[model samples]
Target: MAGSELPQEALWQRVAGRREGVLATLGPDGTPHLSNVYYLADPATRILRLSTTTGRAKGRNLLRDPRAALYVPGEDFFNYTVAEGRFEVAVASVTGEPAIDELHAVHAASGAAGDRPAFDRRMIRHRRMLVRAEITRLYGLVHPAA
Candidate 1:
């Protein structure tokens, strides 16, 4: 779809519905590191939000390198919405205070009530950090076989 006509709501729906996406970051060895993560995407702002443990491969990788990519598969392996973006990492100095409350509110306003129990638990357990990524490029790919 053309950039102007790229229905942000539809894109966000696809993202929120997916369970896993490949989060690629630069490893310490200067190679790509990929991991699966559960994430929240805000269509209006075009920001994808995710949370990680205080210290993990992905987190460490982000610290070393802020550039990252996220890939959400379509119906099949051949079809997918891939986003190449860079994150401005904001580590939470305080713990347990609803990291993405604004985003969550947006979701709610859009009639997209997420997994409440899971969200509550996350709000309670992990320190909230925000990764604001500006989607530099996004495209949908479909292989011939699919």
Candidate 2:
């Protein structure tokens, strides 16, 4: 399969605009496990930041193994970006004001939440941990018309 190289700027824009992405990790049984996540991408550093509750399976898996894969498919389904990445997991116990502020701003802009209270509750209940993924390998796939 032929693929195109997506520039850094393009990759950031695409990931930032997307609503959800699938995170792939290895299960306890050695099977590939997938979960949907809301992420923030810093194209400048080529790092993808994912926030989740600290005690989840994904979080636990990262604690055991740092290797992971992130896939953000295009809205059109025919075009998508796949990134095989790796990160060093850090347990972020306390959520900083700056991070929450940025999350609020991005959430508002994306229209991800229907209301502020609901969003705030969701963020609060979940123990926030940051998964900083460095893009080790990236490729863009465009499915041609049949």
Candidate 3:
């Protein structure tokens, strides 16, 4: 409820573009932890996907408590979108494959740092976890006022 309501179409436009976002999670002691992470937004599904290692604080926090928030800032600083929801964290399987391997493809397709294979190898070696944020509440002014 922080910003004025924005149309979903406009909101998705702001999100679909390339941008890093701030993710906030709660520590075991109820302290807040924030991290800057690259993300993929599926406006069609209203889900946000992020890749992280299981040993990382954000991933650990998600496992302990599913609640979290991802704030995506628009090209204009003041225009931003915050998607708050519960996380579905899936640790890599025995084959060293994170559940949302397609997420790697998405990132790669979006011009990620390296090739998909290299990214996959890195994620596997690091015990990566794929997190899907099921948005419960969205906030911010993703679009300009008419």
Between candidates 1 and 2, name the one with more favorable lDDT: 2
User: Cα deviation in Å at residue 62, candidate 1?
Assistant: 0.3
Q: Rate the local accuracy (lDDT) of all candidates.
A: 0.66, 0.68, 0.75
Tens-digit per-residue lDDT, 1-146, candidate 3:
24566876666656656458999999999999999988887767877788888898998999999888887887676688787877898876544254747557456755763765666666677787888877767777744443
Error of 1 at 76 (Å): 0.7
Model 3 misplaced stretches (Cα beyond 4 Å): 1-3, 96-100, 110-122, 142-146
Between candidates 1 and 2, the one scoring higher on TM-score is 2
Candidate RMSDs in Å, in order, are: 6.0, 4.2, 3.6
Tally clashes: model 1: 0
The best candidate by TM-score is 3
Clashing pairs in 3: none
Off by over 4 Å in 1: 1-13, 16-19, 95-128, 143-146
lDDT at 136, model 1:
64
- The prediction achieving the highest lDDT against the true structure is 3
Report model 1's TM-score to 2 decimal places: 0.67
Native-to-model Cα distance after best TM-score fit, residue 115 in candidate 1, in Å: 14
lDDT of 3: 0.75
lDDT, candidate 2, 39-132, per-residue tens: 7676567777766655888887887777788889885676777677777665533344455544555455456645655555566667555577
lDDT of 1 by residue, 47-115 (tens): 777766547888888877898988898776556777767786666543334555643443455466377
